[model samples]
Target chain A: MIRRGGRRGGVVAAGLLTGALLGLGFPAPARADPEADRIGFRSYFQQRFPDVPAEAWIDGMYAIDEGARQQWQEIEDFPPYEFTVEEGQALFQDPFGDGRSYGDCFPDAGRGIRQRYPRFDSETGEVETLEVAINGCRARHGEPALSYDSKEMLALTAWIAYASRGRPMAVEVPDDARALAAYEEGKRFYYTKRGRLDMACVDCHGRYAGAFIRGDHLSASLGHPTHFPVYRLKLGGMVSLHKRFHGCIRDVGAEPFDEQSREFRRLEYFLTYMSNGLEANGPAVRK
Target chain B: MRDVVTSALVLAACLALPVARAADDSRTPAVEGVLAAVESLRAQAVTAGHEWLGTRSLLDEARAAAASGDAARALELAEQARRDCELALEQARREEEAWQGRVLR
Candidate 1:
């Protein structure tokens, strides 16, 4: 009887050991530490490209690819976005039907303020994007909201981005539960795999940054938000950040969230926060 | 006379089998059932916020096939859509916890 009991005890111990070994394949629950995450995120890229300075990330693929940089410099010389910027300036100066201009709705007359976007609204318990704020301004002045992808909207954002050319990204996640939740949700969205391709944002931008996909080199996620509302030669027009997000999602075989939707807004909030110190360099040209 | 009748009946039965099989080829009810299942799965995937880009287009194609009386084609498209939704939902479930591991820290 003693020998039989010993054998049973040995079997139970072996089962427990096997279970523990299998558990190693799964991830442990991570503690929420935004600062630590930011440090690790920056460190990964810094280590990957030891030659590139941290600030140079704002130039995106141009910072890494020498050939692309030369071509981009040539394009910048004759900046195609000049016309759009002028149109945006005209729209900004023109008064609404209510005799109030777009400047009447924003602080600093809406100049040099692109970096303060994707802000947390304490009252609404949600993230508010620059586009959403622009629409809010329109509504207040009894004007119709522009479509998120409209030429007018792109022009306005391009001008705002141009105005704040050298300002650093200053997105802040307030010390509130809702704000933290939004940030966490956005982070999850960034890492979560979706679509037929089963790829996440991190797979391309994080894991394979500076790598060539066909003719296009993938840019690091570190300073992705800094240069947006970009004029793309392929598109022959200006494209907003959210529009790029839509394209990325679709490229991965995932249905994208609507432009300026809650999901995209939260994503923008989280992404902008990741580039907190990068200078805003938008209304730029791209391939 | 009885033998002759039996032979004729066997020939008729064999001929009728093809006709019955032809009717089964356009099984509209089967296509409808598959489409229904695909829709339910698609809804779950959409709710989970992991719907694939091709799922909706496949579902639309299935509906068009069904309207055009191509039951076999409709069922094929619906099944493809159903598989897409199932994979998306599985992805959603796996990523729910797994995403934390991919975080930079």
Candidate 2:
């Protein structure tokens, strides 16, 4: 009887082991450390392109495109995004309906804070992007929030990015489980293949970085977040990062979620956090 | 003898023509069924917020082949579209449960 009871216990233990193995193959990862992920992410890019200077990554596609580099240099002489920056400066200082300005809502009067954006907001238990934070500030002042991809918001972020230029990105992923979960979701979104093309974000920016495809060089993902609200000569206008996300997913023939959705917000949080040390070099011109 | 041969030859040609045409026309209902399945699968994918990828383009090509009277080609394209939509639906369902395994930790 003791032997039979022992045999039954062994079977139960074996069943539990099998279930644990199956769980590892499916749901939430057991190990989730932001610092480890960041280190691994940077190391992967550095190992792939050992010759490219770390700082040069800020130039994005131009880090590999010589011709574009020259054109980008020329464009910088009189940057096309200059006018939008000026417009944003005006908007930043202008008061809302209650005569309270955007400066009143942020640390240091919203002077130089672009690099710390797409933060994991513990209070909300979600990732909050710069756009959302900006809108939140307006909402607190009894003003209607601007559109996620609006011209005004683009200009506003451009102004903020310009103000924060040269400051290193310092996004933080807290010790909280929700913050780690948000980052993990973004990482999954980055690597997961979707659409008929069966492509992930890593397929281009991670795997094919510096390779030219159809008259364009694939930029490394390492410093992709550094330059947003970029003036694209191809589009003849400034394009926001969330807009770029939508365009890329569509390029693979996938249906994209709306900009500022939870998926995208978490994606932004992960990417911005990954670019922790890169300088904020936005309102820049791009091909 | 010459008249008999010519008349027999003409009779043979008439009988063969309908048989070949019937063979082609026989594929029409099967193609139509697959096309309907593509739409139904696409609806499922959309409800799940999954992208149907090139399914729509494949469906369009299938209709174009049908319009051009190529029953075999139409059937082939429609079947491909149906398969792609089904795959998309499967991918959507699997990702909901499996995306975590691929996460960088």
Give the 10-residue window scoring lowest on summed lDDT in candidate 1 chain A.
A24-33
Candidate 2 C-alpha error for residue B90, in Å: 3.5
| Top candidate by TM-score | 1
Over A87-126, each residue of candidate 2 has an lDDT whose tens digit, in order, gives 9989999999999899987777566799998888999999
Top model number, DockQ:
1
The ten-residue window of minimal lDDT in model 2 chain A covers A23-32
> Residue B66's C-alpha lDDT in candidate 2?
71
Docking category of candidate 1: medium
lDDT by residue for model 1 (A18-130), tens: 78766756555544556667788888889989999878988889989999899999999999999998898888888999899889977676687899888999988999988
Candidates' DockQ values?
A: 0.60, 0.26
Fnat of all models, as shown: 0.86, 0.41
Off by over 4 Å in 2: A1-29, B1-49, B53-82, B93-105
Candidate 2's TM-score reads: 0.76
Q: How well does candidate 1 match the true structure in TM-score terms?
A: 0.85
Where does candidate 1 clash, by residue pair? none
